[model samples]
Target: MVAQDEALTRRLSRRRLIGTAAMATAGLAVAAACGGKETSSNPGAGRSAGKEEKPRKGGTLIGAQVSDVNMGTGYPFVLLAENPFLNYLPVEPLVRYRNSLEPEMVLAERLEYNADRTKAVITLKPGLTFHNGAPVTPEDYFFGIDLILNPRKYGITGSFQLAGFARFITDMKKVDARTMEFTFDRPRANMTDLFAQLPVVHAASYEDVKNGKAVAGTGPYIFKEWAPGQRLVFTANPNWHLTDREGGPYLDGVEVRFFADQDAMGLAYEAGGLDLILDAPATLAKRYRARTRVGPKRGLVYAGLNVTSPLLRDSRVRRALFLAVDRERFVNELGEGFGTVTVQPWPSSSPAFNPALEASFYDPEKAKQLLKEAGFSQSRPLVIEHRTTQTYVNIASVLKENFEAIGVRAELKGTEATAFLAKLRAREFQDVWVTAHAFSDLTPVTNFQQTFPYQVPNPSFYENPTYLDIIEKLSGIDPLSDEAKRQYERFTQLWLTDPWLLPLQPTVPVALLGAKVRGFDEYFLAPGGSPNFGTIWKAP
Candidate 1:
């Protein structure tokens, strides 16, 4: 009887122990959920967010790319293609687009114009200094404009738009240390937008821009070293016009490394050696996008037509080619992400994008029918010549496959960069060509308006009368008026519908951020993505 009683007591004891353990686990779960603490599904995720992610403070960033690395003259240099993102960093304009895309002051504290809008007077903030501690002065302004006016001095950057101002620019005189006036050739409603984006040149940096003398600038970082076709290094300029109160750059130093190709750029990113890589095409950029914390942003890619080609002489043929290519698969397969397929020289993300434009869709059957109607048969074989650079070679391959599927043949040709530019500029190429176009953004106008159709017999060989006429009309609109808004929308819609462009991949700035990177959120520019090396700090 005593043994039986002892067994019952032991059974109760065991049940009580299990109940206590269950209560402890339930308490822990409730504490985790209520306190908003994660209970380690991966454990590494919380550790990474806790340990690896650090604020950007001060570090030298190394940017990489596959394009030309020439230090520009502020004229038309290869830098415009590859380095303009960094170039525009320091040259602040009087007015800038705020978070809401409204114009706000940056360098200039205030601005005024004549009664007729022909003359704009600007007042710079006092005490602003260049990287070398030179005070901001108007002479530097004249020097910049002078460089653009003389083709030999600086290449024809804004030559076409400036041509309209040639006679009107009666004076680009500095009235005082902080005051300057621009007397235009004619009354321009959007002149302030034009004025705000005139990249300010530092007088001290002229020697470098002129002869590759030595890189110097007014940017947040100094142009410290450049190993041509290799790497560019920049260190902090403490005197850079930045202040936390002003909502400005937050870190120090920048470095840009050049790679032989996108594959190298990717490898560097994986190795954690590069801070940013700019100018990578669709395939590589998309691959990196999968690993990045944020998705990729769309920028512009120029889908050029060899308009001078006899095959493109028929407007129907040109329009038919637009339908023949499968832009969706090209962007998805080659450029992954939530990519936007655009068909204009302008980036759809730009502030200047007229909201009226709707993107075109890809329809292979429609394209086939269009080609057949244009007299291209399975046997006649209408041949469109496509030139190769690197990115567009994929576009051509897609074209060759898709076009052949649609009863068309494309002759693929490869050319060196210099020859390619020359042939296109001379308008001597046949059928099709594609190139990457990087444009600087102003308030209402897209950069590189130099490509706008110049007058017939024009040296630029860009002859699109409709584009020219629209540019003229839009260029003259008062940005503040509703009527101007209507024109902006109309022209933007015209750009997509006229079938003059074939946009491909969106812009993705490539960079492999190291464990040391910091302060990456401070910089801003018109092109959707670029590095903020000034705000980046290295971890100890």
Candidate 2:
């Protein structure tokens, strides 16, 4: 049986549950005089962070690459309404994100939830349009959900998010062109916010999706050009729906430069050719934060063992491997400072956390004794292979030495992200792999739903029956009042009794922004808890 955390921990170290929308919403309240009884009825139209600072106008932002989704029509099969990562054009789904990071309403004026998390009623801001000049309607929002619901549409397939959503959702009717009434099988507190999950597609183009073409999305910017693996460009939508305080995008275009490795991105950043690098390693982040015009990225690292390995089949053997190494010393090599060693899959900051699970410590002699008892004499070396990347080679090397000292023969299997993840997904190695997870949102269940394979992203190969049960409990759309606490206890018991994934500290990505860059923090954030560079820009 595997350990599971359905209530979700904030950090990835403990294999926590998926996080919900952020609790830290910015209180950028506007003057009551300027504010309306409810403000404009436009999508994402609420008065959020109506900053006194003037919006800068007229410059393209050039930056380095993070993940490789938007360089081209990766989803040519389903014409993407908006590149999930590169959102040069901003739009709304009633609730839009501030800096496009978390859910904040723009289109939908109000989000009212029923008591059971089964249903939600909404009121939208009126006269909202997409970058393509399409007027947004309730049918459009309905079509967005339909895109993901219809398997033939080939959208958000196998998502744990749909685990709850697929249950109670019933019908969406257009109360009027702008006002849509969404009813459910029971009650859904999250329905109005589900758009936070899938990118909204144009209802006018539903025929396109049925015809086997990707639907178009209305946004602030239109995809003008993409040069795969090299450079991609976007021209601002002349008809962009939202503008700055004074209606200014302040620039005509945005460019994103891709590099094969971080070193190249480093070179570009130093040469003042790049504005930001959202995908650098911890070691590199420390280097750049000290020497360059960059900032830190919030990242997580943990030791994940392949449960299928015969050598680690025994609980004693698994526990021995963990006790053998010095995680604190090893992580010191990355220089992100001492990260809170994960006691379990959840972050120590989460409400459901139990600090008692952090007791797993470094004990090499004990590790040696356990292995010997497990029948490993000097005749055989406990072979462990670690997969890694150039960014953390030094730390991986240190990890190898620690395990080797405890009567284990650990080999370095450092590979790049593509190859490394391929091996991970295939479960080809019998040892441990050091990796990080990009949390989807603030919701603990979202985190758990995602990692536990309740349904989003992709299913986990490390699937355990024990974990599956918890998934059923907490992932229920209409969760019981005690479900949160129950899930937390179940997860805590699993970790304290039988540790699965070892916890690690979270590190921030080191992003080097150029002098011309103005909106690095305010915008250019990634969606799904990962880095998204859609709002990034460069000088004209």
| TM-score of each prediction | 0.75, 0.69
Candidate 1 per-residue lDDT, tens place, 1-540, comes to: 124324533443333110000011111100000010111112222124546554545445566666554444343222245454445544454564322233346567667767666777778878877766677787776665666566465443223333333334778887888998888766665454344445565765666654544444455666666677766666666666655444334446566777776677778776777655444455554555432222223245545565555555555555566666676676667666434664443333343443222244456776666666677544334443343445667766776776677666666677765456555445555555665543323334434243322223232233566656655665544433444445445454444334454555544343334444443432233222234434455555
Q: Per-residue lDDT for 419-511 in model 2, tens only?
A: 554454345655566665533222344455433222322322455566667655655432223456567667665543344555554543344
What lDDT is reached at residue 141 by model 1?
65
Positional deviation of 262 in candidate 1, in angstroms? 1.5
Alpha-carbon lDDT, every model: 0.50, 0.48
Residue 79, model 2, lDDT: 18
Q: Lowest-lDDT window of 10 residues in candidate 2? A: 28-37
* TM-score for candidate 1: 0.75
Model 2 C-alpha lDDT versus the unseen true structure: 0.48
